[model samples]
Target: MEVMDLGILSLVPAVIAIVLSFVTRNTVVSLALACLTGTLIAGQGLLGFPTLLKTSLGSTSFAWVMLLNTFIGIIVAFFQKTGAIQGFSQYIQDKKLSRKAVQLVAWFLGMFVYFSDSFSPLFVGTTMRSISDKAKVSREKLSYIADSGAAPVSVLVPITGWAAYLSSLAIGVGVIATQEDAMNLFIKAIPFNFYAVFTIIFVGLIAGGVIKDFGPMKKAEERAIKEGKVLRDGAEPLIGKELTEMEPYPGIKPRVFLNFLLPVMMIVVIAMGTYLTIKSAKTMEAFLFVLIFMGISMFVQGIPFKVIMNTLTDGVKGAVPAIIILALAYSINSLSKTMGTANYIISVSEGLLTPQLLPAIIFIISAIMAFSTGSSWGTFAICMPIALPLAFNLTGGDVTTLVVASFAAVAGGGVFGDHCSPLSDTTILASTGAAADHIDHVKTQIPYALICGGVALVGYLVLGFMSI
Candidate 1:
């Protein structure tokens, strides 16, 4: 069957997905329905389930990502099971640091966990939440700090899993001469990533007391300060109360923090180590290693092998929802691209695409896709193909600066959406990591994210004209 462009129908899947997610608050059901809608459109039939799953999960290119992400979830559960996560914050609490120092440490750890954005929240948010709570910091504040640290820092850092994936994509577009060239261009584009840079700086400023938290964040902070309520009275945390509040298993070793830090350090070391050697990433490797270590550690601590397996399963369970969401996120992106969603948007914006406005336009559109879809990687996948080619052609394939700006726009815009969208995995993980109410985290964070997003918009406009 010949598939029609469907004009605006190309966008229906994403819209339906987002609306369902918001209304139902169940990402799995929402994404599944969205995928079905798009698959039906793309295949022009009701029997596209296999095609949909293949596009989302069975694609060799994305299979690793889904696995890598799910393993991170397992590792988070491991931390919970081993009592490592608790020990991390407990170790920090031992420092008796000031409130600002604690926030600063949390912010820095987000940067430190630069290898994987998924792991960043699980490690930093989970580790720092208790310390922040002890310091009278709201869970909203904790999630914001974690969310900001996770994607923003990973996107900027060249050694991260994010960079490797993006670099491979950039090279595949045929614009760059080689993967090395793509890597260099990605590094050069970092300074122009306004949303990421500004978001990071904004968090630091808040941590340093240079800027006050306003909007919902302020109220949450005040509630924490005065009422000693880290969470709103009726808020529901994403990770269950039993897990977040669990104690070390019976006869556990002296250094619970070691259990946390060792596996975390290995994730970084292994990812960077292999990335340097083979140019293949190690997110999955690290997660598997952590899982094995946790199981053994727990078993050694007198827990039966069966119970240890249960703990491992529990960690994977935390990540399962996220992985399912990720698969659908991919499916929607494929459907949108196949349907020409980005091209449709670009086609409409043709009248507005001056050289001076290209960066800003790309940034805005990228942000829209990411926010709507709740996946920065998906936004990059959708928009980069369209944006890069446009940048290449619009500039006669000669201007390096314009290309860099466009690259920055895509990356920055994706982060902007990921930052604000309640549906984003990074945000959801942030809520779980901090043990905050998911919607509350979204509510309190939107205001601050938008503040930085506004700054990024104006900056892109200025840079666009400067490149001209």
Candidate 2:
């Protein structure tokens, strides 16, 4: 069914949803309500919400997300069950690294496993958690490192899933004439991806102890350094207790080099190899390949098949909340598209924004929208169609720096929410991977994210006027 033209009121659903997300601090509920509101508005009555949701769930993209994230959960569980995480940490510990060195290593490992953002937190967080704890590092800090390592690192690198998908969005906006043009623009936008680049630098500063902790993070850091507590007292970790508490099978020694290194190498190699050759990285396929390889390796090591199956089930169980969140995220994005949220926002701002302020305005709007929705990809889906065209027109068709700045704004702004929002996939995974309390992870991470956002905000404002 076609949507009713609500004119300016098309903004109401998203506004309410964004308000609810802040007031309730419940991501799934906020997004669902938002989707329902938009769907109802689109239908001009109460009956259409269900149909909109049903369609969203049945969509191919939603199914792909479910499978992709489900596989990631299974990978996390399999590694934990097979004791690959523990073995990797043990290997690190045996080197007798200091706390600083351990954090630096974790920071680097996050970037090292940069093939898939979906896989990075589980791989880096699970593997590094033990080592970070041993080094007296706070779980909150570890979660930050893992998230920063995954999304920000992946965003800047063209070979990863983030770049490939976003490059397509650039093409969809009709600014770039072809996929090749979009890819070239993506390359040019890299340095202007200020938030992502600054975020990576901030993580290094934290890991290297150049940036002192403040906010909730400082308290968490103090507890870790002064009291030797990795997680705060009575905090509930997002990852299942089963996975975190699981042990290696009896009398089967885990090998860091064989089990950990080999499987990780396979995931990276296949992800990059396929992307370079085929243009699509196919992250889920890479994960499945490593998962099967992990299973065979475990079987060779004498792990019981039943135990492995159970471990995989536990992995899926752990990811259920995240999966629900992802579904709701897609639903809202689709509904908002139907409701004309992006067009309304653009229409309202059309006369008010000057080209001198376009980049800054786009950056802030994209960041806020992404943060409220808890999906950077969805934010890109919404904002790119409007923002890209605006920048293209404002600068007389991509001839100047404004076009690149706009692309960077959308990309960086999208990642800004991924870093700050509790509902973001990377943020959630970072908490899960580090075994940190979900809310605690968000509270501790947001301050640092704000720091990066602030810097990027200023940079965009400068770039905006420079375009004039």
Candidate 3:
């Protein structure tokens, strides 16, 4: 199939997707419509939509992400069933930490559970919710801490799924032949991942009270402190009623190490150990192993097979929402590639883009793309292929400072946009975990994310100029 030159028309799908997302606040519907529009614009007609869906969603990479999310959901349900999550929270509550201390602890815990974006926000928000509430911390504040710590922390580490996916993208580009090479490049880009670095530090500063809360968050905090109301009047938390009302099995004691910490550590050890020994991180394998281990462990502890199966089933059900968004995201990305959206943008900017300006421009574009799509990984899938090769060409195919900055720009921008998007799965999960209203979480978090995004843009500009 020959690629058609749609010129400026290629922008239609992404623009329509972005505009519709804001209007509907429905990422799945937005992406589906965008793909349909792209298909028609490419002259593939109505039937082309199904053909493109098969071509896009049928790939090995899409299957890997879908399965990984399912396994993560199951593990999360396992934690909930065994009461390990609540047990950990109880332990924290027993410490009798002050308001500030609870916030700081939640921040630390979020970074500690850095392996999965899906897991980190849920874990931090759920584990810290009761303690934070007792400490008079607002649910919005807790959600912000969880949301900021999730993708930001995950992207910084080299052993998790994020690292694996990002490094894999850099492969087949100039000089990034193997996983090891791409991983090395990712590490080098860390310091330049300014948005993530700033967001993480910003959360800590606010959590520790070193920096005063401002904007809507400040109002929420004051309400929580002065009125003892963790939520605004009539605020509806994003969490389902079933989750809020759930109780651990009767007569079954919770063991944090056996039920939770051990499984988490296993994932880290297997992923990190595999990367060190084999030069390839087996992230999926690690998740699969943990899922199996947890199931067997629960059974040995007297959890009936039927109950375990039910929990697994519930986990799959929970993952269905995110999986739907992910599948559509993959489809839109495929449609974008086939329609040459990235190419058109590049072609139109060829004369305007200097090597010294590439990093800043790429950062802004990637951020916009991620914000519109509401999926950091989806943004990564689309932007990395385009941004990396452009950087390579601009830098004479060397792994120069400009190239590294461009790479980091894409990673950091995706995080920023994902952090702020209400349609984002991680953002929604953060609200659910903290029992915060989904809209409130988005409203309160955006000011902080924008601050970091501004700072990151400046850093990119500086780095780009320095490369000259």
Candidate 4:
């Protein structure tokens, strides 16, 4: 396939993709459709879609991410089925903390389960829902806390699947030639991920009573305190009784350490240990090790072999949506490359971008893309390839402070948008876990998320000039 400049027209595929995602609220379909549109625009006709899929999805990076997420899903299912998460929740209940303390505890728990953004919110929301209700904490508040801790914390942690996928995307772009360099760049950009950092801190402040609630959240909090109603009157929670009320297998006792904590510890130790000794982090290997350990431990604890297999299959099934989105994302990325979309943008904007404006602008654009599409990983797939290369071009192909700031802008912006978007999986999961109304969760979270986003924008503006 020959790469075509397409001039300004090269932006058509991504633009159509983003617009279609917002209008249809279906990222997978939007991406696929956009790919077809791209093929037509590129003069490749209908056959280009298959060629694009083959070239994009048939890669080592995609395989690694797909497998990593599959293993992660299995672990999540195992944790749910074995009642380790419930056991931890029970342990927290035993502490008999105050309302503020319970909120803070939920926040901490969310950050502790930092490996998967998808897992953290569901675990924290479910774990804290009953406890928070007992303490007169609103479901809105609980959902906010759960949602805030998820993607914000996961992206900051380097030993997780987010890091693996993100760093993999950076490989062969600009100065990020190897996995180690890409991972290193990711780490170096951490401090500059202002939106995520600020959002997490803001949540802690609100949870700990250091900050007062405002907007719809304030009203919900007031209602919870005065009327002793955890949910708004007539509110319909997104989740049902069947989903919220999960139990361990018959006659099996839930052990938090064996089923949950130990496996998480293993991932951390293995990932970080490999990164320290061998430069590149063996993130996928760490997950694989933990997956095996989890299965063996569950089997030892009297779980039937058939049940274990069933849980594994369910895990794979749960992972399908994400896998499909990633596959489409890769295809679009390939399409964008073939069209030279980023190159066109760079060529068009070269004279307009200033050091003081670039990072802030990137942050705003990335935020809009993520919020509209409501998929942070999808946002990453589209934005990173464009953003990183632009950064490299502006910084003369070196991984300088300017380049790092630009990278952080994209990452932080995506998280900020994810936090605010009602269509986001983490946000919806937060509502389900807290048993809160889905729309109510979205309504209450926006004000808080915007405040953090606003502050982050300013931070980016300052850092951009300083870096340059």
Candidate 5:
């Protein structure tokens, strides 16, 4: 198929899937259909049926990405089954921290985690939800903190997942001599990432109570409080009674709390230790070190081996949808590259837009792509090739501004779309994590994202006109 033909066909599946998801409220089904469509479009007689399956499953980046995510899920399950997360929540509650304080801590921790890993959203979010709830902070607010911190902080940090991806792309395009040089360039561009900086500030403002929830969020919070209902993680309501009427899990015995706390502390200590000791090691290496620590912690906690296996299995099962989505995203990306759909889009847009307007345009385009695809990293990977090349052309090879703008657009748009799209895995996870109604979370988060995105757009426009 021609580039335009492939691009047009791509739209069909996404549109159908989105419409079906909205109508049926079944994201898993919708995403599955979209994946199938994307795979078929990619194969397009280039390979036999068996080979197509093998190609999709064996794609290097996709496979490793899934493996990493699966590991994260296993860790999360371990945290949950061992009562570590709940114990941490209890510890925070016992401290009698104010709601505002807890929220601030959540934001801070999220920012901290983003420096080390893109999985900050899940790790920081799941760990902090119980604490935030104990303080009566709304789940919507918690989601905001997690989402704001994830991509924004990652892009700002030179050694994070965002930088790694962009560096690899730059090297592939021969724009940089090596991944190291590419990373250095990204590091220098950090100050120019206006969207990320402003978004973080916006999160702080919201958490500090300077910005109150408006629109659907305000309504939902009001409704939740007035009805006294418990919101579950993934945003579904338990319904039929006041939240207090719901049975609480058995109170954490001191021993159980100690078992949980000791292991978690060990993980943190070892992760930090590895980071400090390694000096020049990759983030993944540090993650592996922490994983080792986690293993030791598990042993120290005396959590049964069978229980650990079950928790790991449960975690992997939970990640299945995300894994599938990521695989499809990768396939679609490869298809677009081969078909030149990305280049076509870039060519069409480049003529109509200028360097001064590129950031804003890229931001908007990234958001649309992310919303359509329901994957932030996929959106980043897709747009980076087109946006970076355009940025370079516009600036006559001024690498810094172009790279900064491209990175900002990818991070900002990815978060914006992920924040509001009901089809997004993070959106679903946020709803599940908060125990709020899924639709309610989507409805509530949209206004917040719009307001922040508007601010970010203006920031980008102003910055785009300024020199480094």
Candidate 6:
């Protein structure tokens, strides 16, 4: 079969898998099926199945992707197992920190972890939930903070894994002179990232009590307090039980404040040191540096080697779904590129849409695709080829604005859909981290995402017209 033919047919299974996931509320099964279907379509025959799997696993890019996620998972798991996160939580609770202070602390903590977007939400949510609960803050609000901090901070930080990946894409398309140039452009574009900015502002407002609470979230907060429900789901009910069983590191004199303060300060110092030293290094080098820092930090925390191994293993297991989703998303994107589906989209749309409206169109299309597919990186991979070319064509080949606009579309639309889509890994993980109902997290975040998305749309339109 022709590549294009296979590409067209591949959409069927992907779409079906997405629909089934929504209906069944099972992300793992849905993503696996979608991946299997895409691989089959790419191969065009049952006999090619083994080769397809081998290709995906053997792909150097995919390996790096998985390694990055695995490392993040291991670090987070070590933090949790060593009582570091719980100690931090206890310190915050003991201080009787104001809700606003707690939220700001959480935000910065997430920002520090911006090197890995996949792990930011998990780290922030798990580390901060206890403090927020004690302070009577809503878990929905906590999700908002985590979601806002994850991708937005990663995109803005020039030394992050996200920046490297995005810069590589820009360089691949000749949109920038070098990876460093691309990173610089991305940094400059941060001020214009209205979704991220406004989302952070909104979180501050909610935390400060200026916004109070409204909508479904307001009701959830009221009920939680009234019913004495500290956690959201309250079905599995891990928070109280975990709290009761939690103890300081065995045989180590527990200075509650130091236990928390030491780990946090260490994380910040190591992260900054790693960033400065590895910013200019190759992807593998940067990743290795981060891995080493995480390992040493775990050892310094006095977490036993066997326990650290167990935690790391569990962390890797936790990332299994994310890894699968990313690989499949990459496969879908690869198949699309190989089959010229992206080029076809660009060619067909070029004459029909005005140059000034291309960014907006790309934003809308990306939003829809991400909402349906529930993977931001996948959406980015699939859209960048076509969108970047369109931006170049639209701007008469001025690469700077075109590159920024294309990235804006990817970042804005990717977050918009992922924030609201129940099937998104971040969405699920946010709920898991907060112990909130998954659907509730999705429902509460929709209005915030839409509001920011609306601002972004207007900003893109203004920029597009001015550039034209």
TM-score of 6: 0.76
Model 1: per-residue Cα lDDT over 1-468, one tens digit each: 233466777778888877786577665687788878887877657778557677556676468756765676666666666666667767778889988899999999988877777778867777787789899999989988998998999899887767877777777554587878888879999998999999999999998789988999999999999999999997767775445655556666546656777777777888788888887767677678877776777677777888677765666666555566567666766666677776666567778877889989999988987876677997887777777777777678763788888988999999998788765778877887787877788878998889998998998899888876
What tens-digit string does per-residue lDDT give for candidate 5 at 305-352?
665565556767766655654554454444444445444445456565
Deviating ranges (above 4 Å) for candidate 3:
1-9, 24-56, 133-139, 160-185, 219-240, 374-400, 422-440
The residue pairs that clash in candidate 4, if any, are none
Which scores greater on TM-score, model 3 or model 6? 3
Q: How many backbone collisions does model 5 have? A: 14
Q: Over the stretch 2-102, how does candidate 6's per-residue lDDT look in tens digits?
A: 44544345355546555665565554566556656666666656645455556656787678757766665555555555566666677677787876788
How does each model score on TM-score? 0.87, 0.89, 0.83, 0.70, 0.77, 0.76
What ranking emerges by lDDT with the best candidate at the front?
A: 3, 4, 2, 1, 6, 5
Give candidates' CA RMSD values in order: 3.2, 2.9, 3.7, 5.7, 5.2, 4.8
Question: Which run of 10 residues does model 3 get worst, by summed lDDT?
Answer: 238-247
Root-mean-square deviation of candidate 1:
3.2
Give the worst 10-residue stretch by lDDT in candidate 5.
238-247
Off by over 4 Å in 6: 1-3, 6-10, 32-82, 99-101, 172-175, 179-184, 212-216, 230-251, 255-275, 278-352, 372-375, 378-382, 397-407, 421-432, 435-440
Error of 3 at 411 (Å): 3.1
- Total clashes in model 1, counting residue pairs 3 or more apart in sequence or in different chains: 1
- Which candidate gets the maximum TM-score versus the true structure? 2
lDDT of 3 by residue, 126-211 (tens): 77887888889999999999988899999998877688889899999998899789989999999999999999999999999999
Q: What is the lDDT of residue 404 in candidate 5?
A: 69
Candidate lDDT scores, in order, read 0.78, 0.79, 0.82, 0.79, 0.61, 0.63
C-alpha positional error of residue 364 in candidate 2 after TM-score superposition, expressed in Å: 1.2
Query: Could you tell me the lDDT of residue 448 within candidate 2?
Result: 91
lDDT of 2 by residue, 1-468 (tens): 454456766766656755675567565677778777776667646766677778878988778767877787887777767677787777788899988788889889888978777778867788888889888999998888888998888889988777878888888554577888888888999999999999999999988889888899999999999999988997767776667777777787767667777777877888888889987786778778878888887888888899888888888888776677667766666665676665655566667567888877888777866765567888887777777888877766754799888889999998997578665767777877888876778888889999999999999999998888
Full-model lDDT, candidate 1: 0.78
